[model samples]
Target: MQKKPFTELGLSPELLKAVAKMGFEEASPIQSETIPQLLTGADVVGLSQTGSGKTAAFAIPAIERVDGNLRAPQVLILCPTRELAMQVAEEVAKLAFFKRGVRELPIYGGQSYDRQLRGLRDGAQIIIGTPGRVMDHLERKTLRLDQVGMIILDEADRMLDMGFRDDIETILGQAPAERQTVFFSATMPPAINQLVKKYTKEPVNVRIQAQEMTVPAIDQSYYEVDRRSKLEVLCRLIDLQDIKYGIIFCATKMMVDELSDHLKARGYSSDKLHGDISQSMRERVVAKFRKRGFEFLVATDVAARGLDVDDIEVVFNYDLPQDAEDYVHRIGRTGRAGRSGRAVTFVAGREIWKMQQIIRFTKGKVRRERVPSAEEVEQKRTSEFLENLRETLEKGEYKRQDTVIDQLLDQGYSATDIASALIHLLGGDKPAAQPIVEEQPRREYPNYQSREYPKYESRKSSPRETEARAPREHRESREPREAAARKEFHAPAERREKPSRSPRREPSAASHEEGMVRLVFNVGNAHQIEPGDFVGVIAGVTRLPKEVVGRIEILDRESLVDVSDECADQVLKKLNGIKFKGRRLNVNIAR
Candidate 1:
């Protein structure tokens, strides 16, 4: 969290004034490290996550590098998505506020071409654009980068992962041979390294404190559960919380079966899914789950990927995921459809490191919560019963039982005794495993960027506070979906959403072809992944000929790509870790 004042980072007085107006006095770690180097005409590969003030790290230097007199795309920035292009352009505008005629324009798909054409004709100096649209402009000669002195790739890894490798290289190839190229990304995978080696000139590598922002709606917390007591913790959470339905993700098929069996035996309506289940059985389980036949579903990540349900109130990470990305995938099942949700993760012994990786990658405040005690669960159950009883009484629905109550009253039982016995009878049998009792105080991370999840016992939202917060929270929930919609429909950033030119190829996944290996991609039509995407991304990243990339078939939740056996390993090695179309493609040879 250490920061250096912007004044010390060598910004011009006017630009510094603009920064002051922005109300950020100090540079975040990334800015502190990369600002001076970039200002001095050195290429930079800033290694940081989103919300780490990465925008300013490149934006400030870009503003400093722009020339007002020769305003013809002096600074070109390529972002992976239209939303990011807009965001970067906004930041650049803020930094260039004090300077005159330092025109900045954002050019991306789905907007009226007239606006972009006018902006280009006006001799805009800084051009921000997504790869596809930028490629379009370049092909039509509507934009030129011959005068560009500096080029920055925002979220470089993301762009390459989204299958923009060909367009990116083509655009970069058109730039002058003498230019500064920079990259900012959350990770440095192989494809990124290839780009760096090919384009940059002795770039300074700055990997500062990882920074990320998370949704305010999800209440993310982890428990220090013993391996033997994980099932107990799971049951305790179900008993103590108002869980409508939930998904519990484990690390293995065997664990899914074991945990599902345990929950069902405890009278919890639950089901399991894993690699071992047949396709028909899986479909049956999914259908029953959708109908609310089961309140809980246990599965491994592999089995859960194809699930198309939403409105899950809770997500239980019964075992810590192997990596940070998987952690995101596991917890993403909840907190959807504009509803607040909870994610409870169980951390055993050595898996704590994996948890740390997740925290660092997500920059999320995963509060360390104490395990619920037996007495606490019992108290929660009793309180819930009383509330339900009160609701039933207030609705006048208890009158139907008045005759039975009268019979009991005539049997010499006082009202208080009858009520207490009835409450006891309504309380079901206790869980098989006793809840873990830990005295560890809850840990909080006020420094990390996360929304506070209010505890049920102490949360107090007045009517006015509730009214005030509703709009803001509603906006918060819509932002990501808005960005996602832009990606899906190829809509422009900060503009009205409307469908137009298809984002990806319009056809489904292609059929199998002879004499080639078919590779399965984790993303499909739902994720805006398409057929031509595989051809371009695979060939461009692997440096293989386009002819080597064969038929591509896009499906609802996945896609298929065909490649010669000779080139399959190369494709997997370089492309596996990259994200395509904003989703991780776990590319593998289809069975």
Candidate 2:
């Protein structure tokens, strides 16, 4: 993706300033190609992915063509979902910051109709809405497309797939016949191409070719953890790996702030990057990151655009991106400059299906992995401390403190006891590691929702004191433990797990376990319900934690999931009639 500078795009000085304020230094390929054509009133069929900067491509031209003084709906943009509509509306507002009297309103289902009516009545110059809501407004005559001069359909393929063709056609039919129609889609299916032929007038096709996504040097992997345990798991990973320079990619600015703050409170060196920070502050934060002032720089996808840090050791997708292209872009930040980087994604319940989408899109191998245990982090730290101590002794630095040691030694403290006391005092300043909940027997599952690992907490000790320790024979064998500790992240498909001595067994297929009930859904592989779908859907619909949702078994045409007995009825009540992939869900207790 060769991004074009905005200066070369013929944008007016004011719009350029607005773009600058939006923090984009260059126009993406789609933006550069479509801006000129769109400005000249050419109907465009932009074929690009979600994160290819398509929003600005349509937004800038729409802002340029809107008649601010006239204050009529000169521009109409239709999106497939309320979330996308809101995002597009925000982008338009940002780009139109300098253009006076230009107002953009987002109207979508599940919002207050009275509020939308008020916005429409206020002479909004631009309207962004979903097809269904737009059709509703049109039927009520609350929204008139007669004054619309240009109409854009974003995510056209998605809209058509969501069964919005009739509503979309009706809305377009109501628009002025002479209006310029632009369609941007990730793929040009037959339905979309037919739409282009019938509705567009000799449209200029702007297709961004997919670049060679060569990330062989980066080892990509995913962790199936619960939403509540993400932070703990992230901390454990950072500690175990001792990641010094890394970027933690978040899905939203709020998540960035919360994560950064949480890391700091946990005594981790970290900071945040987002739009809310002043440019000067962002520069300072980036400068500190470059100087290794912090180990982690948490940021959102939009805020990290155009960031050119090459030596990043790792990239953690704190939240899975909605688009597969965005996922690639996020992980691509690392593994640059011929460096072998690590990319880890945290997939919670309901996001399991999304993770698969990314794997299919990238055509790259991704393997499931377990989170580092609390004991593992502690062992790493202790090993590092001893190594540093050895280096200090080799340098003869300990001699400089001999006088203090001599005094303590003379006061009845032996040499080994003195060293242990000093070590204890040094370790006391560090915060105790958080324990991950052990909600179930340890075993590997498709999406190992948090509470997967058993808890391990070290006992506290006084200075120079000792406790009963396990015998060497009974203790964990040092060979396997040391091998596990020394192992590095390998290419997803190339890594092999070290065998454990303990026996492992799969859970019962239909265990109406104590305090839980087995529930079945009329969706499975044929319906495209993969391993994570039942877990994701049940937790998503019921708004319950994934812990209460137990083992899931997906068959050909049906699936069985264990749910807490207390919430079984709630799940049954909430998910009985909901739709999944255009088919109504039918959930019931498994016989």
Candidate 3:
């Protein structure tokens, strides 16, 4: 059977152009089947797992039907979290980017109401938002649905799980009865089925087969490490594997923030995505990750919802998800678009039962792998170096540096000694050993386990007291404020701060007494500079052997390259005077 194209599915030319620019050559299984029926004005009920390209399945059709000239909202998309709302809005914006006068707005909690109000007044044709914030806007009369032509309930199962049924029903009731409705969910519970029956009118059912729920392309594995040692194990795995992009999923927002910060401190390119961050910051983080500015992203389950990145090479379950279904979603971030990927989970003691449940749900085998030790990392590095050397030898490109190798051999050094020395000079230290951690015993939940539904409570603020407080009350509370103000206003000499470790020090073209001179450059891997580029540019410009390069430390914005201290002046003169990759190399000394 031949597959249909987005243009053939009755999408507008502007939307087709947008999809092509996004590099989507063909539609996913769901999109191919759902878009045609959706364009025919029939309601849709789509059931597919996460990472199944479901967002575009409905969004493309919705944007095509949007009346761009209409200032009022014509389409409403209800998501479960602020992160998902923003993600959906981003996708919609891309589809509508070429459409003139079309605007899409995303509304969610933790965002300034004034900003959302301003957007509403500015005329948004489509509104994608969370249920709580949507209800808030409806109550304030900022979002009117009288002109709404279509409504999409995304992640319907999660909305029910989060107890948003009342809010969803209220919002749906506000829209016109004749509008088209679309319902999408990962699972069809009795409640979800009931809601579908009451809301959708003779919806066209499009379901991906059960076999498609589990992604076979992903190599799923887990390591039974203690909770305390998980971070160490993660760092070791990252160092061992050549990962391009990955996501570390945690159960809570607090854990995501902590893990992101810890990885950043450990010299990893990482960012945090969660519910607590502002909408603008979340967008910026996603943009950075998409642009390859950051290689790793740490996020909670709610924050990662609606994420649709296709190049994630791996998914790390930093903490096991609370619900078994979330295990599917976390791993689904990878192995997308027919590409093979990997998913590694760190399972601690007593959580083995949860792991078992996940394995059972996916009906997939997760092999247990032993953590790599320090000696293993060293062995991997040695193997990589030997491979690179063999490639260079096979290419027959070392004739220019033959004299340098002969001189080193003449200096009472054997081939093994020279290679070992080179390895040692290239930051080839063994990985540090991980600390041992003991798992705590699990305790059973109380009798409330059977009645585990969420409960709601309302708390109102207390009224002010009629009588005035004593002077001590004012004095104690205001003292800290006054002290902070005084500290801010202190004189520069009185408030001397510690000097930064990365002080600016220019490179000197002078000879050194040592065998090699060490020079640092304000460029590193964080600046998208690779090790080979650093060595190649220096060797090509100086007519020196690449093997003579010593330890190179690539920091956030600077790189330190070690050359023979004797030839440091010559190397500096050659490099500092030339340009590499269109940027002048700032050769300097280590601070």
What does candidate 1's lDDT look like per residue over 405-484, in tens digits?
A: 89999999999999887765556344322534332212111111112333323445322123123333221210110010
TM-score winner between 2 and 3, please give it: 2
285-354, model 3: which lDDT tens digit per residue? 8888888899899987667878888889899998776434567888989988889889999876535655
lDDT: worst 10-residue window of model 2: 477-486
What residue runs in model 1 are displaced by over 4 Å at the alpha carbon? 209-591
lDDT of 2 by residue, 402-473 (tens): 789889989999999998988976764434445564423222211111223223225443211110122332
True lDDT of residue 575, candidate 3: 73
Worst 10 residues of 1 by lDDT: 477-486
Question: For every model shown, what is its TM-score relative to the native structure?
Answer: 0.40, 0.55, 0.49
Q: Would you give me the overall lDDT of model 2?
A: 0.71
Sorting all predicted structures by TM-score, with the top scorer first, yields 2, 3, 1
Candidate that would win on TM-score = 2
Candidate 1 TM-score, true structure as reference = 0.40
